[model samples]
Target: MATIVETAVSAGSFTTLVAAVGAAGLVDTLNGEGPFTVFAPTDEAFAALPEGTVEGLLADIPTLTSILTFHVVPGAVHAADLTDGLKAATVNGAELTFDLTDGVKVNGATVVTADIVCDNGVIHVIDAVLLP
Candidate 1:
């Protein structure tokens, strides 16, 4: 089993996310011990942002880091564990609301794929970039 960072790199769909993580200097934290549930946004999701959004975020480390961390929860929260209206605290010091009523949604981003187990935690692929 690979770490969350390793798994994302191997998946090939999270290129933008991988780069942002590196730029935000969060590669080491996401690779750390214990468990983390990451709502990873795909490259296409990042591309969906405004034309200059990605470039702007890459250059702004603090804001970029906050946005990145907003997608991560402290524990390994699998889809099965999620319930309607569940609120989970993120490493960014904010909370993500789960809406299981219509599929799974985290802060309005649909979960395209769920429960990707990693050596360090789990990765749930989301369709939009979550902002804090």
Candidate 2:
């Protein structure tokens, strides 16, 4: 299996995500060893943001990096392991809250796809971009 970054690139729907990761210089981090649970947002999710949000973020490396890392947790937490009200610490140092009560939400984005196993981690596709 490919790494999280590779997997997202292959999925094709995450073009914006892939580009953001690159611009944030987190491609190597996501490609590193050990498990990571990423709430991968699709291109459409990024598009849903207010106008100019994406461009503004892309221009700020620190902020962009923080937002990207906010989508990732330290370990590979599968869907079954998620509880109704669970909060996990993200690499960005913020806690990502889970609400399984309504189809599994991270922060505020709903999980559209879960448990996409990668070589060194997992990816859970989210509908909206989670903010930290």
In model 1, what are the clashing residue pairs, if there are any? none
Please write out the lDDT profile of model 1 over residues 34-86, one tens digit for every residue.
59999999999999999999999999999999899999899889999999999
Error of 1 at 62 (Å): 0.4
Tell me the spans in candidate 2 whose CA falls farther than 4 Å from its real position: none
Which predicted model would earn the best TM-score?
1
**Residue 42 in model 1: shift from native, Å?**
0.3
**RMSD in Å for model 2:** 0.7
Task: Please give the range of 10 consecutive residues that has the lowest summed lDDT in model 1.
Answer: 25-34
RMSD of each: 0.6, 0.7
Overall lDDT per candidate, in order of appearance: 0.95, 0.93
TM-score of candidate 1 relative to the true fold: 0.98
Against the hidden true structure, what lDDT does model 1 obtain? 0.95
List TM-score per model, in order. Answer: 0.98, 0.98
